[model samples]
Target: MQLPIKKTIDSVPGGMMIVPLTIGCLINTFAPDTAGFFGSFTGALFNGALPILAVFYVCMGSTISFKTLPRVAGKGGVLLGSKILMGILCGVVLGHFLGEVPITSGWFAGLSTLAVVAAINDTNGGLYMALMGQYGTADEAAAYSVMSLESGPFLTMVTLGAAGLSAFPWQTLVGAILPLAAGIVIGNLDHKMRDFLSRATPVMIPFFAFALGASLDLHQVWQAGLLGLALGLFVLVVSGIVMLVADKTTGGNGVAGLAAASTAGNAAAVPTLVASANHAYAAAAAPATVLVAASVIVTSILTPPLTAWWARRVGAKAQL
Candidate 1:
């Protein structure tokens, strides 16, 4: 008999991402003490997300050819621009109307600039690449290089800063962009090197997803409750729509846009990182982190089938 984990992982749409992530969340939740064992190497391997993602970024970058740079940049740029623009809009509108402590208001009472912006600004690069690999071309998956720039809290910081809510160090921005840039430089220079590293992208995804998920606390899902569910829907519906339109406008079917719609798994950490960078958001950080984590789970589940449906629809139309 084969491992059930493998069967389950292979069965799901974004199973490579969802399965490890689910397992990580379970470990973090039920076996919280497990993190304390082995001098905590298991915890570190699962929780040290940024460094792992940096390596993953390099591998992803290696797959993109300099010859296809324009197309990759174009698609990635459109998705990135739409994500950032939506984030900025939310921040500015909320900041202008509700002030920095927007959570005190009714209905949208549980939300704040940090949580909302972070959730919106980032895209699930792993999920997007997976979806694109299934429903789109290799170049479309390569577009994640651009989308990956939105990985950390940089764009969230920028959105909030523009809204008069917070400020962050420029070095944080540089630190986030460097790995992908290094990968691109190396990948474009050597074909053999690119081919070798490109093979590593799919293989590294589950590890990255596991690491990302380990950083999450499932209890956050409970803490976020209905509001977290709403945020996930907002990302999928609102941001998804914008990306879908941007995709079509930039000469794509709707699949790439839908693929780009999910909130990144790492986004759960953005609120805490943002709080660390700026004291202003410190009070909101804990709850915001939980809420964003919930959003990650929600988006991860929803985006894949939506992309597949759109892909099938587009394919049917083409056949017609």
Candidate 2:
């Protein structure tokens, strides 16, 4: 008997399942109780696979020379910084206005930071480069993608916490930064492992996505009605405006298309890390994770068209 290798979800990059998986989640409105329809095991895949694939993408460019980091960081640093600043601003404003109604400090921080995080995922950008036939835009996104691995969390915690949207823990900060350092090490020294993980990570996506969708009371995304619809529309409109401005400023580096399609989402890490520091927020963990999970599925579907449209408007071509 021959041993068989399973061709699970990992074999497909941008697959058929993503659409229904992403949009079906919105059905939580009509179904109200239908969250997690994708199941735990499938949810687990979404949770675990994203970061692994992220690291794998990083490894692909390790050979470009470590020295380029400064340049990469310099140019990409602005994008990351902008993300953090915008998140902080939004979190603070939303928190203050809502004033502990449906809003908690963590709520503000979570959603705000998530906006930026959701808007961008370093790993996803890298994966896009790997699978989507690298173009100038992909490379441009990849350049900054490396910087975002650590920066996303760092910015979220640092800015949000410091701004008082959430509490910041010294120990957790130290711990979180370690993975980024490790990512750099792995990115440079273990390209093969990085590649392997990237390839393997997709297997976990569905599981991750399903779990997040399960948390919401579909009624909230629906019965809450106009607010929920407005929220989604606001996110889209705001993101588009940001993309246009970025495109103009960057001389159409194609970074705008990438930035427009950031879509990293906070994933499990956002709530998990925040909850680790602020025990009061433990309940929010699931929602935060799910929010990010959904963001990714949606972004994956939205990014290509958004990027192309932005690219055309700005006259930028794909870089990587």
Candidate 3:
């Protein structure tokens, strides 16, 4: 039997979640103690739902072939580097600007730096590739390009973890490496295995996104005060600058900055770990977590067209 689709489904993936989450946060401002209501919901959903996302990532990896690795190397390097360095550079510029904004405390300043960084989520990266019609190529360029983003989140996690560690915490990285290695092994197996996992991943993606969105406190938007607004505007301006600079330099691989802008989010995994590592910033942890969530939801909506526009302007092969 065919099930009827609700009009609300459109709001689920589109702008509906953003409005509610913002509203949730604002509700928190009136009863400062109530901020935890939305925040805890977010924490439960993201923290609880993330392991499933990890499993999806592992299954997606199960499909990789070693032959594709080299292709990811030559041209892929330039493309991937453009995404990373451009992000870092933009981050640095914003960091410098915020250095003067006194809205954040010393600890918050640290977490915000982490927040601006981007990582390659398998779900978003896959969507980006398909949109750009980059699914199959000599380099498996899209997949490889994604791996570059994939690795950075962990790196960002570790770096943020360091705010209190005083030195690189090899132990945390070591802990994450085993599962990653295991995933790579499974990801490189028989094609059937990879294919099965790939199919399963898409079905699971939205549930997580929706659940994550439901957890956000929309009320925070109002309570976030002037500082959050200032920061959000900074992200918009810096992201635009990145697109302009990248177009000039990369011979134009298509304007990805706009796509990058809409989807600009920290690796969802970073905050809880960072908070655990540094006790002082536990308060900043909730806000950082919400900010990343909002960015992900907002940016996901913004990326498609913004990317297409940039793609046409630069005459790049992909919309990216």
Candidate 4:
């Protein structure tokens, strides 16, 4: 008897990314040493999120045409700007009330401006692309080329610093977009190369999703507790609203904006990176990491369904 595995996975909204991710999380949380236990190729699959994502971005970039570059940049800028502005607003408000130190007591313990801004400032590029591919257009998906600038600790640092909290070097910013740039150059130069690379875009999703999930531990979500859940909800709701408005205003139906409201899986690393850069954040770093990780999982699970709903509400067609 054949199992209806693909059908089962596809039945869930964003299941293509979320189901594999959930599996990886379960494996990492329970075994914890599975990668080490199985070396070589097996291990690499468990730990190769960034490399796979780099290739995915290049493949995504190949689908964009030079003629649509302006529109892509325009849409991306609006979403990116809206996200950063929301982070800055939240950070400034929280910094005024909470200052640099995280709450150390009660139900809200470990909540900090650092955590909020970091979670809000960065969007999950992988999730956004996946949702856009399913529910949006090529220009919308290509919009990530500009938005990828938010990937690392750079935007988080900038947001926190604006709130009086912390450079990631200039090279860091360039390195983030290099893969997409390479793909753009190649694709523009050769249509055959563009078609070939574009085919790999969807295929790379599950691989990177599982790898990203392997980097997480569900225990961190538990350690973060209610406050972490609250943070995740806050990111989804607050950032989601602003981004939705931004997307619609920029000639979109709000799908891309809503799709972008989730936190990046790698965003959990920003807290420690920021703390290392400026000791002022050192005390809040550990707690912030936990909270951001929870945001990653929470947003990853929720953004897809919510984006799908919004897309349907606005009559956006699913390319898939």
Candidate 5:
């Protein structure tokens, strides 16, 4: 008999990433040396988050076409700029108060500028497209073509640097983007290559997510629960308002803007990646990862209804 394993996981918001991550966290917390006991490819899987993420970024880049850029530039650019600007604004303000370190006590323990920025900066591209397809114009859905630029940690790194919290080397920044840049070049040059590589994007999420989880303790994940929920609300309300204004100013109904407010599942990987680049963020990475993962689940659940409500409030017709 066939089991409902995949179906069960699919029932939860961001479960594909979150479930495996939780499993990894359980293994790491209880049996930390399991990798050594089961040395070889199994160990590699437990220790290979970064390399997997690098490949995942390339696959993500392959999905973004240079051709789509010009077509949806106006709507897409406005949404993209608004999202990034909001993330930077929050990062700068929090960095001013929190610096690069996370809170270590009380209800807000584990909160950090890094977590805030990472959660707020990335949009859930898959969710945006689905919502826009249902309640917005074709152009609105296409707008994610530009927003996809926020796929990895590059924007978070820049926002943190701008906040004066950490300074990444010029080479570090270049190294961060090189895989994505290479994917874009190859994708643009060959349609078949683009198709082939882009298909691997979803396939890589669980692998890297599991690896990322292996690095964290359940205690940190447990502590981040409330803060992550609060951060998700902040992303939806603050980023939603900014993106709404942006969409309206660009001759849209604000549905697209609201749709763009959710955090992507892949965004959970950003803190770990950022920490790897700048040790200053290392203290914040594990908690930040949990926080971002929480944001992913929180936003994924809330955004659909929020988008639908906004579409109705503004009299935007559902395309369905």
Candidate 6:
């Protein structure tokens, strides 16, 4: 019998992403120290999710062109603005009521500013690009360049800062996407270089996904449980509606907008950064991180089918 593990994963909606991350999490949980054996190189490469993600961001950036900026900005701006609005909304509502800590009630224990903002702010850029490539145009996929600006904890920090929860260093905000900025510069300068690097964009997804998985402990997911699942659905419904409206307003049929609704895999890394930035978030960070990871998995699995279904509806209407 053939194992066909890759084929199996490729067959699922977000299988290519979800499968590797599942494997990485299992290895980290069971073997635990396996990442340390190879002179901690595995730790540096796989366990260090942020560094891996930074390189992946560069690859993603190289696919975008300055020539497409006008169209990309128009499309990307709406989605980005919608995401930012929802993120700030969630943060302000939670900060004002919950005060950045776990609510005294266990029912809301998994909810926190870090988890809420991170989940809402970041889009699954890889998934969006993939879906847009299938259902929309090249310009739609290229718009991910602007959306990618929401990659790290910077926006979450900004939202928190606005809510009076924490103050963030401006340099760290700029530092987060420096690789992406560099890639954009070089990509715009050389057509051949852009084409070469663009091919590598899809390859980087699973690579960085595995790295992201190493930081997760499955038990933490269990602790997050139902509430985390609810948060993911909440993101899909709320942000998904806003994006659909934005896409329609920007002369799109809503495919790209619905495609951008999911939480990004790298968002799991944000709570730690948030906690590091402000000691107040330290108590909630661990659980919030796990919750955000759960959101990533849930959203990744859910968004593609939703986008496809929406695409079909739009197509059917167009034919009518």
> lDDT per model, in order?
0.75, 0.46, 0.46, 0.80, 0.90, 0.78
Instruction: Rank the models by lDDT, top first.
Output: 5, 4, 6, 1, 3, 2
Q: Estimate each model's TM-score.
A: 0.76, 0.63, 0.65, 0.68, 0.98, 0.83
Q: Which residue pairs collide, candidate 6? A: none
What's the distance in Å from true for residue 84, model 1?
A: 1.4
When 1 and 2 are scored with TM-score, the better candidate is 1
lDDT of the structure predicted as candidate 5: 0.90
Tens-place lDDT digits, model 2, residues 225-261: 3332333345445545564455446555543535444
Displacement of residue 187 (Cα, Å) in model 3 is 1.7
After superposition, which runs of candidate 4 have C-alpha atoms over 4 Å from their true positions? 1-69, 167-221
Backbone clashes in candidate 4 total 0
Q: In model 6, where do residues sit more than 4 Å from their true spots?
A: 1-3, 36-38, 43-46, 100-105, 133-142, 273-280, 308-320
lDDT of 2: 0.46
Query: By TM-score, is 4 or 5 better?
Result: 5
lDDT of 1 by residue, 1-320 (tens): 76687777766645676577667877877877676675467767766755666787677666656666576898888888999899989888877765555375455555777788888888887788777776788778888777776765667888887877656678866665666667777889998888888888777768866765666667654556889888889888998899999999888987899988888766765776676667778767766766676677788889988888888888822211
- What TM-score should be assigned to candidate 6? 0.83
| Best model number under lDDT | 5
Q: Candidate 3, residue 48: CA error in Å?
A: 2.3
lDDT of 4 by residue, 163-266 (tens): 76443445654565678678888888999999999899778878877876676677654667788788889999998989999998988888999999898765
Candidate 4 TM-score to native: 0.68
Candidate 3, lDDT over the whole model: 0.46
Ten-residue region with minimum lDDT total, candidate 5: 83-92
Q: Higher TM-score: candidate 2 or 5?
A: 5
Please say which candidate is ahead in TM-score: 2 or 4: 4
Best candidate according to TM-score: 5
